[model samples]
Target: MFESFWRANGEEATIVIPGWQTMSYFSDVSNLCWFLEPEFAKQIRRLHGLVGNAVVEDRHIVVGTGSTQLFQAALYALSPSDALQPIPVISAVPYYSSYPAVTDFLHSGLFRWAGDANAFQGENYIELVCSPNNPDGFMKQAVLKSDTGKTIHDLAYYWPQYTAISSPANHDIMLFTASKSTGHAGTRVGWALVKDQEIAKRMTKYIELNSLGVSKDSQLRAAKILKVISDGYEFPNSIDAKFFDFGRNHMRNRWERLREVVRETGIFSLPEFPSEDCSFTGDRTSSFPAFAWVKCEWENAQDCAAFLKSYNILTRSGKHFGAGLNYARVSMLDRDETFDVFIQRLYSIK
Candidate 1:
């Protein structure tokens, strides 16, 4: 999706890291997240401030392998070790499918997966709030109301390109990743903006023990990419140079096309989103989500995923996200050519 954008504007995004530049295990011995490269931290704050997606001021940054690792670390940090039973981890229905799989697979005594935050009766739980959520692009909050519960905000899709930044998010633990933000999944860099120092430390400790520290090379590379992105916004001379603008345009166009095909076929339906004012874009922009929450309207199409597959269109089953068989999750982040093929395929569907 972003390959062409980078190929054209990657001159300033290059980092020439020498062998001896960042070879040590520790980036800053004085900082609590000792392995977090200063350059990466600086770039993260600068980008977030520029986008107005999250409030990074006075927040502790914990760099991880990716948002997945940071998510697991959050589970590790929030769960009470001395509790009589494992702390239940819950997210709203039609949540990111990976949440339950990631949480329960570990079989950790500290935390366990409990289906649907709305249905969970336990008082002690950790809630995952993925605004501009993955499987379905809905903005969500902590559905479970309890004094003892903690929330981890997965703001991966909260960027201006995906949805409106109505206001800067000020959650207790907010997660952001480079993959969704800059289309740099290979770098595998993600950070958490945690309000509490103790939780930040615990998250950092999990990383320290898990991977020894996030790769300094990866951090440096991510820093360069982010710096270029922030610079584009600060000094916008060309359309090609603007990162978010480019992303927003691509998403909007793809969504418009997708919606058109859905309307044409009368076999599928998409969620209708209301346009909202974006603080960063400074305009009322409609949501151009990274994923489409597609529903099968045809009576014979009992399984949405399998139906798409019959037409050689791959999609994730909504059942995996705790939704009914009628729904399917389609990725809108593919390259331009692939997306065009998908659009064409949709029209061919009976």
Candidate 2:
């Protein structure tokens, strides 16, 4: 019984090579609310300028320490005004832990942790949905009970590497950050797609309150990276091949390695990953980059996470994602040599 619920077999996995750039870029931010330097502000504007007709008066852009900050701001904007009748914040379990925590910090005292949107009453919440969801990598369809019920889609990993879809404005209050795709976590820049003018203003207010204003320097750096992305220049590795190609190949190889690791051992299992063929007509089924979420047969994800950590392999357990306790999240950024060693270590276990 414990075998299914036991800790991961790859705990404390040595980090001989670093993971995503975001993991290491943000250790120095002592504070996040200060105004950015002038050039930095210009740079941020430049980056947003690359969006190319994507931004409109209806759309409000704000920089955050990361999408995490934006998420908080969006929640605050949606907070109920009347303390006596607070709007409920509902989310799936196994969700990004921040959702509930942010709900608490807003002190709305109205969040109801329902297992899924179906359980959430429309009148209760301005829903927060994470598509291409954190641990599972599954994208929730644009859903609405009626024309007016609110839903904020978190598309933090929706770049071409992860999904073929490029236009990110389809969802309401879309949340994104460079930390996931561009490796610029240090900039702490993020944005939200707010269809409501009032909510947009409130979000800006929250941003101002949270950090006075996001640093202009960080915003500038992010803007530079955005310009390069628009110009087809790679940030971490300025290779001739498209950055999306690099990311796709990199993640694809890692996922293959993961498959190899799991297949080599007779004791593991995986859910059938939805294929690109399953994508909508315009959706590209070509890639699922950014992460490798695997559902292990383990009964409890926390035990699986503990096991991985014991091996010095820092992994976020599935329970953290709000479902499938047997699963764990793994970064797909790995060199072949590191991946080989990781596989060897994984196979060497039991």
Candidate 3:
């Protein structure tokens, strides 16, 4: 989706890295997070400031290999080293499937995967709150209400393209990724905005021990990409309309097409989201989620994903996200050609 947008600008968006440039492991030896490239940090803050999705002022910016690494870093930073047992990590049902998998993959001594924050037992825990959530794009708040329970806000899909920015998200720890934001998954760049300095330090330390710091090359590219995006909005004659405008319009059209096809089939249902006044767009618009939460309404369908597969359209069962087998997640972020084929397949599924 964003490929064309960047391509339209041509060399205006290109970056060149010399063999001699960014050779040092340390981007800023003066800062605690020495690996953090100064340019990347600046662009991260500038983009956040421009969008007003997350507060970046006076907050420590911790970069990662991607949001996946940042999430693990959060878990490591939040869990007390003196604790008698590993702290339970949880998110609500219909959460991002990777939450549990990533938390328990290593069976980390710092934290362990605990499914569904709503059913979580105990006082001390780490709650991952993904707003405009994955699998089903709904706004979320921490379900566990204990003072000892810490929360990490995953705002990966909180951009104007996905949902209305109700207000500036003020959270202890917030996570955002280039994959969702700019469709730069291959770049493997993500960052966290931390209000607490110690938590930021611990997260940075985790990256240091894990990957010996993030890739300087990736960081530089990410910085360049982000600067171009922010520049689109800041400078009117610089290039095109806001980078998000391209994303938002494309997503809205996709959602409309999907909903119409689902209605025509009458065998599937999609969750309807109420429209909200977006602060950025300054218009009342409904969220056009990057993922469509489709549930098979047919009585004969036992597995929604399998049913779609039989139709030669691939999908992920909602069971992966702690939902029923009747429900499935269909990504709306695929290529235009692929999406057209998917829609046609759904129409022929009778």
Candidate 4:
């Protein structure tokens, strides 16, 4: 959907990296693995401040190849090393599908997938809280209230384009990725804002063992992109500025159009989100979620993904996200032509 937008403003988003630049694996003087480039860190802070999406003060920034790596690092950092039993990792129902796999794939003795936090009764556990959640674009909070439980806030889609920047997020551990925020999925850069130094160090160690560290080239490119976004805010009226404005407007338009199509179908339903005041935009706006959580209401179309697939519209099955087969997720971030095709197929359903 944003292909035209990017094509029209390509020059402003372009970055040129010298071949010899960032040849070293090391990103900073800290010698610590998972070291974030100072410029990258600075740019991240600047971007957050400009966008009012996340709180950065008094936090240790740990960069990763992407949030996927950081999710593992968070599990490593939060789980006790000497524990006799595997630490339980959990999230609420309809959670991000990758959490279970990311937590259990290593078969590490330190942690194990514990299923839904809402159903869990464990004392010591790590709960992943996704606000403006993955499968469903709704705000979420920790369901487990155990004193021994630790929480990692995944604020990947918390940008103004996806949801209102309600406030600067302050948590013990918070994760953000470039993919959802700036549409830089290939950059493979994500960062965790950690409140504790020890946890930060341990997460860094996990990154060290995992891939040695994030790519410096990716970091530099991400920094440039973030800087461009910040500059857009600084000079809102500039010809090449206001990337977030463009993104938010485009997303809102797509959501409205999709809703119109779904309404006409009468076989699918979508979640309703109330408009809220955005700290970044200084106005009230409804959510323009990255994905559409479509629920099939027809008896014959019990499997939402299969139902959509029958119409040549592929989607992510809700069963993958711990929701029932009646639900499915459709990406709203595809190219305009693809989105048009999806809408056409969707409205054609009888």
Q: Write the per-residue lDDT of candidate 2 for residues 215-234, one digit (tens) a residue.
A: 54556566555554444532
| Cα TM-score of candidate 4 | 0.96
lDDT of each: 0.92, 0.57, 0.91, 0.88
**Can you write out model 1's per-residue Cα lDDT over 1-350, one digit (the tens) per residue?**
98878989988887898777887899999999999999899999999999988999999999999899999999999988798899888889989999999998868899989888878887788999999888788788888777888999999999988998999999999999999999999999999999999999999999988999999999999999999999897877642499888899989999999989999999999998899999998899999999999999999997999999999999999999989999999999999999999999999995
What is the C-alpha RMSD, rounded to one decimal, of candidate 2? Answer: 9.7
- Give the RMSD in angstroms, all C-alphas superposed, for model 3: 0.9
TM-score of each: 0.98, 0.74, 0.98, 0.96
Q: Among these predicted structures, which one has the highest lDDT?
A: 1
Q: After superposition, how far is residue 56 of candidate 1 from its true place, in Å?
A: 0.9
| 219-239: candidate 4 lDDT, tens digit per residue | 888888788778777876775
Candidate order by TM-score, decreasing, is 3, 1, 4, 2
Task: Enumerate residue pairs that collide in model 3.
Answer: none
Judged by lDDT against the true structure, how good is candidate 4? Answer: 0.88
How many collisions per candidate?
0, 33, 0, 3
Instruction: Please say which candidate is ahead in lDDT: 1 or 2.
Output: 1
